[model samples]
Target: MANTMWRRGVEWLAAAAADPRACKWEWDHGEGIALLEAGRFWDVLTVPDRLGLLALDLLWRPGLPVPGPTLVDTAAGRVGFFLPPDPSGGWVGSGLRYAAKGSWVAVPPPYRSARFLEWLIPPDGNGVLHPPGPLEKALREAHGALAVLAPMCGR
Candidate 1:
């Protein structure tokens, strides 16, 4: 159920990106990632921002109202959107577990706004992002990049 919701959200974001006025997408090399910020939440591009990357840490308190995405400092530098654990208790949690690849920290409140969600895309060995097989693959690859950023969860 949650997966479906997540995927649908991604589709919607992608559609929004397709919409000329929805989101402004750009790639940042200094940050070693791609970013997409929309004026509203639930935008499809926000899906990658939420699922593709990892927070510097996972200090988010469960059951707390996120209001929106959160930003945190990370070994990779700064990552946005520290998604909370999915209520489904499925691969979502395990998929987001701290890996040696990236740092995991809390997303500060001031940064927790609808416009703040940004996707982090890792570059390949050639320092280029390779398109993955599917949306899930793209998202996982983004997460893998996050692992490369921190490589160790401070927590």
Candidate 2:
């Protein structure tokens, strides 16, 4: 049930990505891995920015209302549309994770899910975006990447 809701949210975000106003954020190396290592992954992106590459980290907290659809550019791809917290701030947890060929060679499981959301492309010559695929493939890839890198990471 929760996963279904999450997927719906992602779809909504993808539609929003069609907006011409949306732009790419920025990417910081190792940030996604760091989020995975830390349980507090929501710090990466929030619930409104845009669907693109974001370079900076946004702030969020329990009971703190956010204007999100928080989009950002990560090393892996354009990752965003974070999960918002419940009304009580319970489940405020979120992680817009990103992974690339080498840097993401080894990431722990805890950060697999929400950390990575969507892979996007510039569908038109306009600034609008075309986000592709579900988080499942990316999660699976991360899982696979970790398996290949884990032996070297000594875990």
Candidate 3:
């Protein structure tokens, strides 16, 4: 059952690529990572690791809805959150970068972590995504938390 779910998840993720079959083939053939186009199935909102981690914690707390797929680029110190495509530019500010329309995100296979890329929250193959309302709230809370801590750390 787990394997089937994972396969479905992989398939779902690959659908974001320009060529789904080729993308899946790359993953199956031991490719560490592949760049998948954004703004199709979903868009990506990227933030600094510190801020993103804090928001992730808040989002996953008891009774809150689980967030969609999240990716971390360790080498780049950034985290990407998958959200429904919002072409009206609603995802600007708070040091967040919106990857919509023409952007691409590096994705590793759902079952494994690539060298500098890892899944902070992996997709479940059910096509769920992070809703904008709660996501913005979580990010604001995270920002406030960091603001409080920054002074103590002299940062």
Tens-place lDDT per residue, model 1, 1-155, is 54554444344433323342222122111222223332332212122233433321222235432223333334433443322222332324342432111222221112112233233321111212111123234456556666666546541
lDDT for each residue of candidate 2 in 17-65, tens digit (9 for 90 to 100): 3221221111122332222211122212222222222211212323333
The candidate scoring highest on lDDT is 3
Answer with 2 or 3, whichever has the higher lDDT.
Answer: 3
Write candidate 3's Cα lDDT for 60-94 as tens digits: 88887888889999999998999998887587786
TM-score of model 1 relative to the true fold?
Answer: 0.26
TM-score of each: 0.26, 0.22, 0.94
Lowest lDDT 10-mer window, candidate 1? Answer: 122-131
